[model samples]
Target: MKKVGSFVGDWWRLVSPYFRSEEWPYAIPLLIGAIALTLGSVGLEVLFNDWSRRFYDALEKKDEAAFWREIMTFSWLAALFIAAAVTRYIVSPYLRLRWRRWLTGRYLAHWLDSRGYYRIELERTIDNADQRIAEDLRQLGEYTMQLLLGFISAVATLISFLFILWQLSGPLSLKFIGIDVEIPGYMAIAALLYAIVGTFLANVVGRRLISLNFMKQRYEANFRFGLVRVRENSEGIALYGGEQREMDMLNLRFADVFRNGWRVLFTEAQLTLYQAGYAQMAIIFPYLVTAPRFFAGAITLGVMMQTASAFGQVYTALSFFVNNYTAVAELRAVMDRLQGLQEASDKKPATAIAVEPQPGGRDIAVEAMTLALPHGQTLLADTTLVLSRGTSTLISGTSGSGKSTLFRALAGIWPFGSGRVHVPAGARVLFLPQKPYIPIGTLRDAVKYPDEHSAASDGEIVAALETARLGHLAGRLDEDTHWTNILSGGEQQRLAIARALVFKPDWLFLDEATASLDEVNEAAVYDALKRQLPGTTLVSIGHRPSLRQWHDRRLELQRTPGEAGRLVEGAAPA
Candidate 1:
């Protein structure tokens, strides 16, 4: 009961936003139209129930004229019912689509903001976020439409049919211990009790399904993700001949899926047996109970049939939750997953990188900066460093000396740290890591990205490509393809340098950006950069001996005895 209460509360919290969002103009009208159509459909059912009694009575009387009149009545009722049903069918999906659109946009924005995607990965706060956003959101939208319409229909039918059953059932007289007693609406009362009992048993049989469904979703997504990873890295695996190892890992993941599938099948099979029996019995239970009165001549044949029809409608309406238990469980799992993603995205970092703007400043300064890994191991303590604007500085350190980590801190992305990083106000800064991100798009779009394709003129783009010795790609700017897979390592790196030239930021930080190129080609690229972006502040992390001559100053991360590394000044060898 407690778990059910929490699920209801969380579902409402997750769902109420769309109705209140900026898209309410469409959402509100579609919702109102769908609901109105549902109520009208219920009214048509009530009319049909009346028509059934009249048609049967006409048959009993052997009257052809009255029979034809009732047939006409039914034809009109069926036509109206079809109209109501079809209109609702069209409008309900529109409502669902619009709601999903609003919700998908919001979730994507929140997940991408504040580096939430990156932070969630570093901390492992949530698993399968991508799947939750893409797949589970779609499920939520679909289930929400079906469940909402079903609930409304159930409630309305229960109300409309309860009165019909009561009027048709009349009264039943019973003897108990030599005393006589009469019960009104006996068939209606019987259906109420039957539905209640069935619901209780179904809940008892199916209550464990919610948590199982949650884990099953996670495990399935993990298994699928593993296969996708293999597909993306198939080249590397083939080169290393690690097919057997990959197969073993994949099999291990699939075992979880197989094991859980059996459990789900077992539970569903049990529930299905009970549900099938319950539904079949409902078809005849109404007749069995009310036939005694009919045989005794207390009611006519038409009354008996009307009574059975009304009883069926009432019972089915009351059994709504019992019939939809599995769907409810699945919806609960999706809602909980989405709730976890939202909570993880909203979490505040324990440590933050403080970026301060210095007015009229010419240098980037780090004061009392402390660097720590995500696991809380300190890398650098109380490190202070400065890089003047329009000057070339190279950062050299031993392996694993927090060189790339420092660059992340300066970029205001590494959050497991405390420090003040002051940059010149209004200065544009860009960071280029060794493996730069190459989005799947046209060559022109990839070069300008993080920028629109039209951000740079054609002449400027051509000039930057020529300077980086990537003139071969200039003509292919408008051609759409996955340039990442098509370009070689050297070409990709050169394309990244060309991006820097096109963007022309005031400060550029390179973390082994040119490591893939030959020494001569690397030198030529640097010389071209110097000629093109003379006013840009260049800070680089490199290990090659040939890189020292381009930079005027150098800094190194030196180890201290029994303590973290410290940043200090250093000089290049003559």
Candidate 2:
């Protein structure tokens, strides 16, 4: 019971967003329309159940005219039913799409907001975010819609049909050896009782199926993520002769999936045995209960048939949980995943960058500060620093000595420890990482990313490329291709520099932005920056000591074993 309550709670949390969002106007109406149509369908079913009795009576009495009239009445009811069913069909898909759209947008916003994506990546968060967003969201919508409509229909049918069956069935007063055994509406009571017992037993036997299904989704996602990882890094793996290892690893994940899948299959088979048996028995149980009354001549054949139909409706209503057990289980899994992601995203507070505007205007400051990782491991400590305007500062240190980490702290992304990062308000800055991000678009859009494609002029873009010693790339700016895959590492780096030159940021920070380029090419890009934006401040992380000569100041993180890296002061006016 507690487990069931937990599942409902989680499901509500997952689903409430759509009804409360911008899509609610349309979503609510479509949902209400679908529900109304569902109720109408149920009403038609009850009417048809009532018709069954009259038709059967006409048959028993050999009344041809009466039978034909009943047939035509049934045809009219069938048309109404078709109309209701069609309305439900039309409204349901619209609601599903709108709900899915709202949910997808909400999840995307939460996942990407305020460097939450980066934090999740660093923390090795719940595996297969891609699957959660793509596959699970799709299933969540489809299954929820089906279950909701199915349940509503079941309830409506049960309530509407039960009264008619009661009148048709009359009463049951059985005497076993002269003792009274009074069962009122015996057929309906028996169907309800039978469904309750069956559903209860099914749940007891299939409780483990929930866990099995959850693990199956996880295993499938893990196996798929492994295969995708291999595909994405196939080139690197082949170069290092690691295909065998990757294949072995991928096979291991697949084996986990196979193992978990077996558990689900076995559990579901056990459930299927009970459910199929219960459903088959349902067809006859009504007739058995009403047979006595029929034999006694208390009711006609039509009443017997009507009793059977009503019994089926009651059984369906009571067994709603049983029939949809698998979907419920799957919904539980999706809820768990989405909730985890939501909690993780919400936990990361927005870290405000402490960029205090200075007297000299736009000078960056890190005053008596420290930066630690989310795990409480300090990356940089006791750092009192200032980067005045127009000064080219180079950050040099051994790899993993907190050079790039400090840059991240400065960028207001590494939200770990206490400190203020001060920069002048309204000052624009850009951080170019080791490997530049080449978006899937025209070279112009890739270069002018974070800004609209329409923001930068073609001549200005070409001029920036020419300045960065990537003049050859200028002619291809109009062409669209996967630039990251096609361009050499050095060329990509040069392209990033060209982007900086075009945007002319107030402060440009590059972490190993020139590592892939030859010394001459690196010098050419650096020379381009000096010539294009001599007044722009540059803070760069690089291991090549030869490049330090271009900077006016330096900051190095001194590393020690078992101790956090500390930023020490250095000379200026290089």
Candidate 3:
């Protein structure tokens, strides 16, 4: 009971928000209409059950006129049933689609907001959040509607038919141990007990399905992620001749999927076996119990057929759980995954670092700032530095000496740290990494990316490209393609430089942003930046000695063994 309550609570937490949201005006009416159609469908079934009794009686009596009358009666009932079913079919899926759209938007916002996606990656607690948002939410919306409406219809049918079955039940008299025992509503009692036993057994047989389905989704997502990695790094893998290694790794991932799939199939088979037998028995069990009265002339043929129909409806309603155990299990697994994502997104991490904006300030300050890796190993310890306005500075360090980590700390994204970073309010700062992200779109859009609505004119963009040594790409500014694949490493870096040139940030931090370019091209890019944006503060991380001429100040990260790196003001390395 507690588990059930908890499940309901979790489900409500996920579902109720949509109905209460701004979309509720549309959502509530669709939901009520779908539910109304469900109840109407159930009402139609009751009318059909009554029709069955009259039709059978007319057939038994060989009354042609009465038979035609019931036939006419059935025509309207069938027409109404079909109309309701069709309307529900259209309305229900449309509602589910809208619900799914709203949920997708909400989850996307949560995942992308406040760099929640980055934090989740840093924590490594959630796996394949893409799948959770895409596949799980889709299944959640469909399954929730499917199961909710089915359950409601089942309950309504149960109530409506249980009374009819009770009235038709009469009494069952039996002699047991020399005592007369009379059972009232015997058929109803029999159906309730049968469904209870079936449901219990189904639960026992399919109890493993929920966890298995959960693992199944995980394994599938892992396998897909592996495939995507191979596609994204196909060039590197081919250069290394690592196709066999990749194939082996992918096979292992798929093997997890395959093994879990077999377990699910076997579990489902067990449940299906029991359910099939139970369903077939239910087809004849009604006649078997109610036939004795018909043979004894205690009831007419109409009553016997009606009793059988009502018994079927009542038993089906009571067996709802038994029939949908697999779907229920799947829904539970999806809910668990989505709930995990929701909670993770909502959770605010308690980090020691505080990033604040200083209004009307001219410099960026790092006060007693310390940076650590995820495993608690110190990267930079108790380092205080100030990046003054209108200065060009270069940061250099040995490989793995936390230069980039310090950059992340300044950018207010490195959560595994302590201390404070104060940036000037409304300051436009840009950090360009080594391999710039070339969004799969036009070259103009790529240059103006991270700012889709930049006010840069086409002429400015083309001039920036020419200045960054990408003059050849000026003609293809409007050509839409995967820019990452099309451009070489050096060209991609130049494109990023062009983007930086266009944006003209007050503070520009380049983390090895020109590592791929030749010395002449790199020099040209820097010279262009100095000439065009003379007031911009340039902070760079690079080991190349040629980079020294571009900056007036140099800071190196110095570290002793087993200690965190510290920023030391020094001359550029010869």
For residues 223-273, write the lDDT of model 2, one tens digit per residue: 988887887676789889998899899889999999988888888898899
| Number of the predicted model whose lDDT against the real structure is largest | 3
Q: Which residue pairs collide in model 2, if any?
A: 53-302, 354-421, 354-422, 355-422, 355-423, 356-422
| Model 1, residue pairs in steric clash | none
* lDDT of candidate 2 at residue 554, scale 0 to 100: 82
Model 2 misplaced stretches (Cα beyond 4 Å): 349-360, 571-574
What TM-score does model 1 achieve against the real structure? 0.96
Q: Residue by residue across 209-327, what tens digits does model 1's lDDT show?
A: 88888889998999999999998788789999999999999999999988887888888888889999999999999888888878898877778778888988898899998899899
Q: Where does candidate 3 stray beyond 4 Å?
A: 572-574
Best by TM-score: 3
Error of 1 at 205 (Å): 1.1
**Winner of 1 and 3 under lDDT:** 3
Reference-based TM-score of each model: 0.96, 0.95, 0.98
Model 1, position 374, has a per-residue lDDT of 86
Rank by lDDT, highest first: 3, 1, 2
